[model samples]
Target: MTETTPYDADRARFTRQALARLVLCDHAVDVADGAAGLVATENDPDSGPGGRVSQAFQLIELAERALASAVIYEREQGSSWAEIAQYLGIGPAQAEERFAANLEGWNTAFDVPYRLDETGRKRIPQLPTAAYDPAWACEKLDRWAYVQRIGIDAVSSGLVMAVPEEELPSVTP
Candidate 1:
């Protein structure tokens, strides 16, 4: 039996966000490097001061956004306010207040895959298509694999656990 728990969901969410944060930070570094080069310009007036300065400020803005995302990720992973506070080097109340302030306009939107019954039947209907969509069935199987990776109970996905390969309709040319 696949083991599923709330912790698994939280962990998967955290993993996804962490990857996004890494990519954002990497971009910030690239931006800073470009700005540094512009700052060293000998004759280009446009690159002398204004350009690099604005880019430098952008680094701060990106860092702040990344920090807020981290806070949200931690919370979703079942972290206590006090724990976050300790990580931020602030009191629990202050941590909560600051995080809330930062996340005021944040959106935690995400997509959920369709559920499937144990007999490899789709629990949710696929979106409108001209004909039977094999890709939709493939996507459902992918979702199940992801659930398994996250240690979440596949049963929570719906009825049966996995989609049998034979259940997927084959396309004929």
Candidate 2:
């Protein structure tokens, strides 16, 4: 088991797709915030070139996390490997192989929420920071999306999150 941080007794309350969306949105916001900071840095006289360059590099990492979140969200939504591969312009096998670990780690988090650190004492959370706490993610993402001029919720990428199981009315199949 890989090292992790922040293991809470309460696991995620959201479904895989909802959690994935929060992760995606969080990363997306980070990338946007980082880029905006870089732009602001350019106007600051005290800012050095290294500062802007370093922030730009951080944006790359944020963007990569955003991409991974997207892939995880897609899989949870019943998107086939072939469909993702088509968009990625790679063969299905290639796409699956590339992202298998990310999906596995996500799925496993529900079963085993955390693992011991190298010292075998401290517990680490397996889920990403955004997915670890549902309420925080929903509030932050909802407010962010609504204020971002995206308007009301539409889908996973849009504002809002999955309704809690208890909140849903019973459906007869």
Candidate 3:
């Protein structure tokens, strides 16, 4: 039998924070890749400003893609819509609608073939599709890096921890 390791509260907290940071870093990498690609495509010095804006747009698209991936991963890990919505600072319905809209496309774009053991069925895992848009990926990387920096501040300040339900202010009459 495999030995089970007991959960350490501090370790759990650290792991969660680390994962968030990783997600942010991934987004930044995507943005950087996109920007680099756009720079390589510029033939006219006069179009530099326009190319920069294009690169920025690509980064926004990459951020959207990264958020989509996070949503999917969280859902698969059993996170509730309400919890996710709270984390995203959005209403549950809005989160569901936004995620659902892009979920299918994201899945289709990144799906990799695989097989299931339980049902002996074949399947594919969804992969991040940002790579398809190199410029967007680069821009996304930049934005993600910025977000990560902000997150680091929040984490360091103890603002990223999960509050106990009892500690939350009551809304009931």
Query: Which ten-residue region of model 2 has the weakest summed lDDT?
Result: 152-161
Higher-lDDT candidate of 1 and 2: 2
- Predictions in order: lDDT: 0.51, 0.77, 0.56
lDDT of 3: 0.56
> Distance from true position, residue 79, model 1, in Å?
1.4
Best candidate, lDDT-wise?
2
112 Cα displacement, candidate 1 (Å): 14
| Best-to-worst lDDT order | 2, 3, 1
**C-alpha positional error of residue 70 in candidate 2 after TM-score superposition, expressed in Å:** 0.2
RMSD to truth, every model: 23.2, 16.2, 19.0
User: Per-prediction TM-score, please?
Assistant: 0.39, 0.71, 0.41
Per-residue lDDT of model 1, residues 67-142, tens digit only: 7667766765678999989988999999988888544433322232233567865444221110123333235444
Better of 1 and 3 by TM-score: 3
Q: Write the per-residue lDDT of candidate 2 for residues 6-44, one digit (tens) a residue.
A: 334333346778878888888898888787666442245
Local lDDT at 99 for model 2: 91
For TM-score, the strongest prediction is: 2
Relative to the true structure, candidate 2 has a C-alpha RMSD (angstroms) of 16.2
Candidate 1's clash total is 4
* Candidate 1 accuracy as TM-score: 0.39
